[model samples]
Target chain A: MLKVSVISPERTLFDGDATQVVAPAYDGEVGILTGHAPMMALLGRGTLRVTEAGGERRFTVEGGFLQVVDDHVRVVTEKAATS
Target chain B: MAKGRELKGRIKSVEGTRKITRTMEMVATSKLKRAQDRVVAARPYATSLAQVIADLYTPELAERFPLLRQPAATGPSGGRAAVLLLTSNRGLAGAFNSNLIREARSLIERLERSGAAVDVHVVGRKGIGYFRYTGRPLATQRTDIGDRPTAEHASELVQDVMRDFIARRLDAVYVVYAKFNSAISTPPVSEMVLPVTPPERKGPARDYILLPSAEAILSELLPLYVRNAVYRALVETVAGEQGARRTAMKNATDNAGDMLNILRRTYNRARQAQITQEIAEIVGGAEALKG
Candidate 1:
């Protein structure tokens, strides 16, 4: 399982365990799964999708950084909203 | 005695003044609480941002981005520098505005002595008023931010400074504001926000995938760093203002109460003296009539 958190300057949009996550990196879109190696990526203006057993959650984030460490993925953005 | 009546009127006025100060104190206390809450709420974003910046910090990365690049020298010809002075719009906040403005002036003077042209960006009416009355040239003057400044306001202010910095017009950017220490104490602080200082690497270095490139990430991260710094400073200044005001109003209320106490004592003593004199006159008249 992947623990994911999406935080913005205004508020936290999501925090839960997820199966997979796809985010818009500066170069291109990147996908992260459980047990992925630690990585740091820059986020562009695009939708971030987090998939879980329940459903998928989507948020639009701009100008943020994504960090994956020890099965925990953290998305820290300046601006985020439900998309 | 008429003196007793005068003392009673004086006591009434003092009591009225005391009521006003007490109410101001209560209002300032509530404002301080709200400002404190906002400062708490903003902490997470700031800490996380700092963590991200610290993790990415490397001397090489600083060289790659102009925002992180430190100039080799500072002289009159080094380039232009900007100072954003944060103060309060209202005057009742004790020495909050005065302290900040004084710090800004000294900062500007020091920068001038070092040979860098400084542009003063004045925020809040108090700063503007001081700069205006002193005939100090201001790059920008804004009084609309008031007591509560949002991230949007911070971004707006940052945009102006960043434009000049990025365009190579400004070599450095600094912010001067009151740093909140406690409800009773805040000190003026001058901080550099531009030519971002990368946090020193600590502990074991963890390898992470750098998407696009380190330079690209720095491009976005550096601006975000400056924005967060400005936003935090704005929030801190607001908190400091409210704290200073709370303490000031509390002192005023306490002083007013003391004055009222003194006035009440004087009134009571005057009334007693008046009564004693009237009693003595009655006794003298009775003795004279008996004689």
Candidate 2:
């Protein structure tokens, strides 16, 4: 499982354990799984889906970045709302 | 009788004032709590942005991005600066707006003394009114940002300044606002926001795969950093405004309570004196009639 955190300037939208995550990068969409190589990408405006144990959570995010390191994923966006 | 009545009226008025002040104090307290929470909520995004910048920043990258580089020369007549002053919309907050305006004035003066041409951009109604009253030229006057400042508001506030800085029309950008240290201590401070100061790197550089390119990422991050800085200042100013208003209202309420006590005591004393005078007059008339 990957520890995922979705943060916006207003609040933290989501933070928990996730099995898979997909984000809309500036150039394209990027997917992350556990033990993925460390990476950083600028986020575009689109939906970000995180698959947790209970269910799948989704957030509409815009204009920020995503970082992954040691199975820890951080999504910081300028604007984000749970959708 | 008239004196007693007058005192009673004064006491009633003070009591009403006390009630209003008390209500305002309570409102300010709740608003302050929410503002403080917003400040806390914004931290995660700020920290992550700083971390990403720290990881990606290099001396070589600074050379390519004008935002990361200091102005080459700031000699007299060579430097251009902009000061963004953040104040509150209303006037009830005691010394909150004044403190920010004072700090901004001094910062502008310092910049002028250094021979930098300073452009003033003001936010909030109080600051705009102050600049207009002083006949100081303002490049922009924005009054729309209220108690709640979002990232969009922040971007709007700083976009022009950032653009000018990049175009080499401005050498530096400073933001003057109240820094919320605690409930009791929120001091006005002036902070330089640009040209962007790269955060100190935290650890050995990791070879993370950079998507798109490092230059492209840095370019995007620089503006985000400025917007975040402005956003933080906006929230802190709001929190400080609420704190200041709460303290001011609390003091006003306490003063009104004291005044009410004094007025009540005076009214009672005057009433007793009037009763004593009326009895003396009646007894004197009865004694004269018996004689």
Candidate 3:
């Protein structure tokens, strides 16, 4: 499982273990699974989806930044909402 | 007798007002903390982005980029400009909304006198309503900024304005909003928004490799700069609103208390007068009987 933490300006929206994460980057949609390579992306306006074990969740994010390092995906977005 | 009754009604009204003001004060306090938290949390992100832009550019291109370029010699000063005015949707935020309107109106008037066609973009309900009511020209408005303003909400706004500028529709874009300095001090101000230019900063050299060309980076970075600027303004506006509301509510509460005190004094005076009149009548009758 990959660790994921999604934060907005006001509060921490999501923090848990996720199996995979799909985010809309500035260029395109980026899919991250466990043990993915370290990469940085400029987030864009779109839906961010996270799958944790059996349950899945989605959030609408504005623009910000995302980074993947050592099996962890850190998303620092300006705004986000569950979808 | 009527004055006494009026005092009674006034006392009740003032008491009711005190309750509302107290509630508002509490509410504004809570909202201010959240707004402040958002501002603080977003700071690091904004700083990093600025750092990236500073590093990602060659001194030549970054400085000479059209957007980064400074205002031209105003050359007879004949072009039209765009105004982005931000106000709160709801009232009771002190003079936060009105201050913005005042600045916008002044700027618009100045632009008009200078032969600059002004296109106005309003955010929040107060601005839209006030301008429309006064029959001022309005190009666009966002009324969805209620108590909580989100970046996603701001993104759409940023995109719309950028499209206009990029399309050569507006010559310049200025944002009018309240800048929060502290709990007690905030000033409604208009600032240049479009044509992102970081003030001249001299720092150590750091190399950056654009995945593509500098032109490619420029395309992406330009929009990002605009979006972030708008987002920061919105965040600051929200914080200022909360702070203004808190101060206004505190004043309201105090005024209500003063009114209540005045009413109570009148009530006591009226009661004493009635008592004195009764005693006078009784004593006069006793004196007449004695005579």
Candidate 4:
């Protein structure tokens, strides 16, 4: 499991452990599993999908940054809403 | 006695005043709760933004970003500074508006003394009126934004300030407002917002994949961060204003109630004195007639 936190300028959308996560980076889509390397990517306007124990959740995020360090991922965006 | 009648009238007037103040106190209390909720709602955004900045910031990159670089103090005297003052629309909120205005005025004066031309921008009716009455020039007077300030309003202000800053028309931007602490807030404070301060590194640096490049991402992020900062300031000021108003109205109501109580006691004493004099006269007249 990977600890993931999705935050928007208005509020926090999600913060929990997830099995897998996929986000739209500036160049293309990137996916993360449990042991992803520490890296930073610029986010473009697209849907961010996170797979938890229950099901996959999607959020539309725009113009932000995503960071992965020590199996923890943090996504910060200007505007985000559940898609 | 005539004094008794006068005291009765005073008590009635005090009662009316107390009713008005009590209602105001209740209204302020409700407003304060709403403002507090807004402050809470606004917190996550700011916290997240700061976290992202911290996570990505590098000392070398901080120097490259124009917004993160501090303005030179030894620059030419023709440089301009913008001051945005947040106040309330209405009065009777104790020193809420006045204190902010006074603090802003002093800041403006100080900026002028330092050879920077100051442009005052005011939000809310109270600030507009005070600046206008004092013959202080205003670059913008925005009274349309109501008690509940939205992110859009903050963005609008941000656009103008950023445009000026980018064009080198303004050297620095400052915000004057009451910092919200709780139900009670601190005195109005002047905070410099422009030439954004680079996030200090608090934790060990963990490398992240920079898309496009680090510079590209920072270029996009800095403006949004500034806008968020402005939005937080506005929300904080709104909460503080409500708090101040609530405290002021409560004091007014309590004082009025105390005055009414004192006046009622005085009226009762005067009535008793008059009644005692009438009984004494009756007893003395009866005794004289019997003799």
Candidate 5:
């Protein structure tokens, strides 16, 4: 499982374990799983999806960045809302 | 009779005032908690942004990004600076607004002495009124931001200033606000936010995959940093305002209580004296009748 945290300026949107995560990078969409190499990508405006053991959670995010170091994925967005 | 009545009236008024102050103190306490929570909520974004910027920033990137580059020298026009003064919208906050205004004034003076033309951007009614009354020029005045400031509000407050800084129209930008150290120790401070001083890189550099290019990312991140800085100042100022207000209202309530105590004592004394005189007069009249 990948440790994931979705943070906005107003509040922390999500923080838990996820099996897979996909985000809208500035250039394009990127997918991450456990043991993904260390990477940092600027986020654009789109829907971010995080897959857990039970189901998938979606967040509409805009203008921020994503960071993956080891198995920890941190998505810090300027704007995000549950969708 | 008149003396007793007047004392009673004074006591009643003092009690009313005490109730108001007590209520205000409670309101301020609750607002302070919310504002403090907001300050904590904003920390994650700020920390993450700082970490990313620190990781991506290099000394060489300064040449490419206008925000990162420090101007070598002031132009013949003499560098321009903007001071964003954050004050409270309402007045019952003890010396909160005044301290912030004073800090902003001194900062503007210092900037002028250093040969920079300073433009004042006043936030809140108190600061706007102070600047207007003093016949000082203000580039912008906003009273819409109340005790609760959102990220959008913060972005709106500093976006123009950031634009001017990037265009070299303004050499530096400073924010004057009460730094919320604690409920009791919030002091007004002025901090330079522009000319983005990248935090020193810590630990060994990680070979992470960069999105787009570092140059492009740094350019975008710099603006976000400025916005975050402004947002933080706004939130801290609000928290400090509530803190100051809570203290002020509590003191007012306490003073009112003490006044009520004194007034009630004086009223009782006057009533007792009146009753004693009435009894003495009746007794004297009865003695005269018997004679």
Candidate 6:
């Protein structure tokens, strides 16, 4: 499993080992998993879905950035909304 | 006796007001400290990015980028101009919202008079409210930017404004915000952003090298710069509001205290007079009884 993290300015929204992660990127949604190529992407306003070790956590984020490297997916968003 | 009663009422009202203002004063002070500290901490990261951009500058890369192009003053262009107007999310911070609104109105008027169309990018709720109410056109709005801000925050705003600039959706971009000087003073300032010109500085040159190309580094760093600048302004604005609120609350509390002091004196005088009159009445009654 890859390590997936979604962080907001005020607090860390989600941090766990994930099988796959999908986020709203600059243009559209991007999916990342273990052994994915390194990429830097811009994020937009939308939901972030992470399939974790045992459960999946979903977050709605508006604005910010995403960095995917070496089985580590990190998301930094301006604000996060959870349903 | 009547005077004492009136003074007592006045004192009680003043005391109540004092309590309220005192609480406000304390709240503002704590917020101000937090804002000031946050701004101070974010400086290194902002300035460091700036320094990197400065280092990235080269005579070769300077020639290629349209963003590096400079516009001469005193000319009206049919091209687009984007304005980044920063206002507070909430009010009660003395003239913070109005000052920016006034300036924005005047600029829009000037742009219209010059036959230039403008696109405004708003940063806070106040600006949003004003522009929406005034029926002005806004390119975008980033609302609810509160006490703490980060580079990530700046990046998003930068993306829109920068894209517009690059796409020629905007010919120029201007940032209007309060330049915080100290706890007591802050002034609204407008700066031209976009076209990534050589920063106007009266300092000595330093040695540096370009990481990729000057253009590449600049393009990469420019957004960060824009973001940091916005974040800085936001933090400063928050801090300034806190300072102003603190001052306003403190003044209110002090005035209430003064009023209470005056009322207390009057109340004491009235009570003493009433006591004296009662004593006289008792003595007169005793004399009559003796006689």
TM-score to native of every candidate shown: 0.91, 0.96, 0.78, 0.92, 0.96, 0.68
Name the regions of candidate 1 deviating beyond 4 angstroms.
A10-31, A46-60, B73-78
Chain A TM-score of each candidate structure, as shown:
0.96, 0.97, 0.95, 0.96, 0.98, 0.92
Give the C-alpha lDDT of model 5. Answer: 0.90
The ten-residue window of minimal lDDT in model 4 chain B covers: B69-78
True-contact fraction per candidate equals: 0.50, 0.81, 0.10, 0.71, 0.73, 0.00
- TM-score (0 to 1) of chain B for each candidate: 0.94, 0.95, 0.91, 0.95, 0.95, 0.83
RMSD of each: 2.4, 1.6, 5.0, 2.2, 1.6, 8.2
Across A1-83, the per-residue lDDT of candidate 5 in tens digits comes to 99999999888899999999999999889999999998988999999999999999999999988999989999999999999
Model 3: per-residue lDDT, tens digit, B50-93? Answer: 65566556667755465664446344366768888889888897
Per-residue alpha-carbon lDDT of candidate 6 for residues B221-241, written as tens digits (9 for 90 to 100) = 566566667777777777877
Model 5 docking grade: high
DockQ of 2: 0.87
Please give the C-alpha DockQ score of model 5: 0.82
Error of 4 at B54 (Å): 3.3
lDDT of 2 by residue, A20-64 (tens): 999999988999999899999999999999999888999999988
Per residue, candidate 4 scores C-alpha lDDT tens digits across B1-291 of 789889988998999998998898899899989988888877866776676677777778877776776677437566899999998888899999989999999999998998888999999999999988989889998988778787778899879988888877888999998899898864799988898886566677667667777788778888888888888888888888889988999999999988888888889989999999999999999999999
i-RMSD per candidate, Å: 1.6, 0.6, 4.6, 2.0, 0.8, 8.9
lDDT of 3: 0.78
**Model 1: per-residue Cα lDDT over A1-83, one tens digit each:** 99998987655678889999999987689999999998899888899999999999899888788989899999988788888
DockQ of 6: 0.04
Judged by DockQ cut-offs, the docking class of candidate 3 is: incorrect
List the candidate 6 regions with Cα displacement exceeding 4 Å: A1-83, B1-3, B58-60, B72-75, B131-139, B200-211, B284-291
> Tens digit of lDDT per residue, candidate 2, span B12-122?
888888899999999999999999999999999899999899999988878899787686555445588999999999988888899899999999888898788899999
* Model 6: how far residue B141 lies from native, Å: 3.9
- On lDDT, the stronger of 2 and 4 is 2
lDDT of 1 by residue, B29-131 (tens): 8888988777777776766677767877777666667676566644335578999999888878788888998899999999888888889998889999999
Runs off by more than 4 Å, candidate 4: B73-76, B288-291
User: Of the candidates shown, which would achieve the greatest lDDT relative to the real structure?
Assistant: 2
| lDDT tens digits, residue span A35-68, model 4 | 8887778898899999999999999998788878
